[model samples]
Target: MKKTLFDKVWDAHVVNSIENGPQILYIDKHLIHEVTSPQAFQELEERNIPVLRPNQIIATADHNTPTQDQHLPVKDLLSRNQLQKLSENCEKNGITLYELGHKYNGIVHVIAPELGFTQPGITIVCGDSHTSTHGAFGSIAFGIGTSQVAQVFASQCLLLTKPKSLRVTVNGTLKKGVLPKDVILYIISKIGTNAGTGYFCEYAGTVFENMSMEGRMTVCNMSIEMGARGGMIAPDETTFEYIKGKEFAPKGTEFDKKVAYWKTLPSDEDATFDKEYFFDADQIEPMITYGTNPGMGIKISETIPTLDDASFEKSLNYMGFKAGESLLAKPINYVFIGSCTNSRIEDFRIAADFIKGKQKAENVTAWLVPGSKQVEAQIVDEGLQTIFEAAGFELRQPGCSACLAMNDDKIPQNEYCVSTSNRNFEGRQGQGARTILASPLIAAATAIEGKIPDITKYYLN
Candidate 1:
């Protein structure tokens, strides 16, 4: 029988079939973080249950930790307490925790992929919504609620109804300055945000085939934003190469065998899908959000859409944008480019390449945060930090900084920001702050121009 990648991984993890409903899927890797795990841990304590697989469960403190000096006390008492409680909970449960200041510590999504804990043909989960980021490695990863986290901890499995498969194929080559983030935003605009509801998205075709593993991660990381339960790209040579020599990947003969198995994880030629969507990659350019939702985006050279055909007018109006107005040359108060979405070393490399010999706009306040300690270390090793520093970009610690404004890196009130993180919901960057999510390349280019502008000139050469 022909099967899609989703089916291959889903069936492999299914331990039992329930009565015409959610199947009992075995979890191979569990990632926990401060914001979501504390409640789950408390629930487990209240029920008097011990974590069944402490070794498989990894914890990190990124959402609540200050990205500045780790030794300095957090200013917000609630955040400080959350971090402390996470440390205590992990210790009591005997779970391996990469705490603040640890080399491996970072955004849960970023740390897992860098450490090679996320792999093909496996089931992974986290308490946070961006757990979909792990699906980029060909794993069946998804986010779960606090109760689901407790269940996974106690049994390493959960009952889930298999999602139907939706194949999204993008053809043609990406244009200069266009990135994975732009491709994704363009797709969402084509098929609204809810197009993939209740489906597991299989991203295939020329665009994904030619994309680097990091690019693939960016695409899959935003799957949930389009209403997909998860998204995946089949394991290819690029995937195996990215996993090789990582901290947790298979080594030696085991690696060869694993690679062989991973090669078969893609959908068969005759496989059938519940739905399929096609896109032209070259049609996309650098995208920037003008409204509260990610789907409310336009090319950097275009004007914001009018309320005539747009459905989210109220939300868009609340975000301080009107229909058909050019976002170019608009005064931007803040610019950020560090999040799980675009904080990898390659991501920074792209940004640094654009601003290497230039300076950030004097009127703009920008923050450049690495996604993980490993990414931060790589930037330092490659001397990209020096270029960024010389160009007036502040290099901050690795965390989900400015993405959710949970940490110290936040946009000031009523200020407009060009950010590379996912989510532009009202106040997502900070209280009353407007967020315009774009690619890291776009974010960097805009930082130089101090507003939305065509970045082709910087990268065309």
Candidate 2:
């Protein structure tokens, strides 16, 4: 029987299986964060369960951590208490933690991949929804609920019914200005949010194969938005190269041995998927979300789709956008350029390349937040910070700034913001704040022009 990459990784991690029922899957890594881990930790404490395999657990402070003033104490009481609680829980449980101000500190999804804690053929679980980001390296990674977090803490295994397999293939050359963010936004827009329900999606074909490891991560980061259990890409030389010298990666001979194993984790040529979708890369362009949901997307050059559904009308009403209207030149007052889906060095470099000598529009309040301390250092090292500063953009410390309204950085009510974060649901940035999801390039251009720009004009000249 030919096994798909998902089957290969998943089967290898199965600890036990009930005939015709759920399987007990061993979790190779358990990642925790301040927001969701507290309840789980309390649950474990209440039940008198010791954290099993503390070495397998990694904790970070994000989601609720302040993005600015790292040296000062956190100002938000709830955020401060949650972060403190997380630190206390980790200390008590003897789990490794990357707290705020720690050099390794970052969004749980971002830091793990950068440090090589996320690797091929592993089963990774986090309380956060974007845990699928680690699947870029051919891993079977997914998010779990609070009870599942406690379950993992107790036994490091999860009883789950196997998800059906799906494959999304995109062939041909991607047009200029199209980033992995745009590709995913385009996919969800085409397939709708419910298309991948009950399936593990494997991203295959030349477009994905040609993408950089960071790009692959961006693609997988939003898989959950499409209702997939998770998303994965096959391990290849690119995967090995990205993990080669990472902090937690295997050393020297061990790396070579690991790569040999990873090479065999790809789906067999004869493997079949339960469902498949094919797309032409040439048809994809820089994409942006128009309505409240991620599936309500349109090419930058196209007008919004006129639909006759009540939910669609409600979304349009909330966004203050009418059907058949183009987003070009729609005045925007805010721009956010960091999140787990982006916020890597490559994303900063791309923004800086466009922002080099240009100045931000007087009307735009732009914020460039790095995903991790390491990425922050890279921004300074590569002088990307200088370019952004010169353009009047504020560079903030690492955290999930404005991606959610948990921190100080926020988009004011009823204002428009072109953001690089994954979701654009109503009030995702702040109470009543409107979010327009786009690639870093689109976000950068929006800041430069103080509104949405004609994306077709970008990277074409």
Which candidate leads the pack in lDDT? 2
lDDT tens per residue, model 1, 1-461: 99899999999988999787788999999999888888888888998999999999888988867888877777889888998899899999999899888999988888898999889999999988778888888899899999999999899999888998999999998887788999998888778789889999989999999998889989999998899998999889999999999999999999999999999898899999999999887788888888888878888878876566545677766777777788888888789998888989889999999899999999889899898889999999999999999999889998898999987677888899999898998989889989999998888887888877656665542
Q: What is the TM-score of each predicted model, taking all chains together?
A: 0.97, 0.99
Q: Which stretches of candidate 1 lie over 4 Å from their true place?
A: 309-311, 459-461
Where is the poorest 10-residue window by lDDT in model 2? 452-461
Worst 10 residues of 1 by lDDT: 452-461
Clashing pairs in 1: 22-160, 22-161
- Model 2: CA > 4 A from native: none
Compute the lDDT for candidate 1.
0.88
Note the Cα lDDT for every prediction shown.
0.88, 0.93
Q: Local error of candidate 2 at 211, Å? A: 0.3
Error at 117, model 1, angstroms: 0.6
Candidate 2 residue lDDT tens string, 1-57? 999999999999899999999999999999999988888889989989899899999
Question: How far off is residue 259 in model 1, in Å?
Answer: 1.0
